[model samples]
Target: MRSRAGLVAVCGAMLAAAVALPLGGTAYAADTAGATDAARTAAADTPSALVLTLSPGESAQTVGVERAVTLTCTPSPGGSHPAPQEACAELSAADGDLAALPAQPQSFCAMIYAPVVVTVQGAWQGERVDYARSFPNECVMRAQGGPLYAF
Candidate 1:
């Protein structure tokens, strides 16, 4: 009878350990939620100065500016897929102009399952300027696929 009781207790302990082990580990919920909130706040704070809408057939845009500006791109969902290629136009500020032109344009390519981000920086009027944007071609393609719809 004592041996049987001991066996039962051992089994119960094993069962308890199995059930409690996984639950005791730290949960990622809090961390994930905080990260998500931060990302949203940053996105809201940094509004894109220029929006370039590219058709499925269209792949690029040339932005004309007098002063140099920093540009950043982050695709929705994530940057596992390719993004469209982008080219920056040369800066042409008037003489004695305080603004600076971007030295290079941000570029990326669109992919089927992967998304990507591009960032560029420069000076304007001797003051530091920054821009941020994102593109998610893969998500768009998954939602809508076609020559005109392909991301």
Candidate 2:
């Protein structure tokens, strides 16, 4: 009877510990609610960071052509990018549509087959934007260049 009572107490203690200690640590309704509220407030108050990258495609073409730039277009457009205001204006005009950006005027381009890839990640105009596109050559990419790809 003594052993049975001890086993029952141990099991009760284990159960209590399990209930009190969740996977993420202590589980308290008020504390969890406060944490969630703080996270929400932080996200609401923080502006999204834009990540842009330019790289040479896997064609063994360009020897060394890689560039990366980050921009925050919300509240204002600013970051490591060279022309923030113009880039922001272009993006805003396109409504965050990468493909909608106007193509540069027609120009003579060599028939090279080197591919270039452009990637943009982040939010724009209160909407999430993740864009990646490949062009057949630097010339073609430049042909499609707006302030977004001027780098």
Best lDDT among the predictions, by candidate number: 2
TM-score of each: 0.20, 0.60
- Number of backbone collisions per candidate, in order? 26, 0
Task: Tell me how candidate 1 scores on lDDT.
Answer: 0.36
Evaluated with TM-score, which candidate comes out highest?
A: 2
In order, what lDDT does every prediction score?
0.36, 0.75
Per-residue error (Å), model 2, residue 63: 12
Q: Candidate 2 residues 1-151, lDDT tens each? A: 9999999999999999888677636457667899988876665445656787778884323434388888876666689989888887777677567889888776668988888888888876445877788888877776786777777
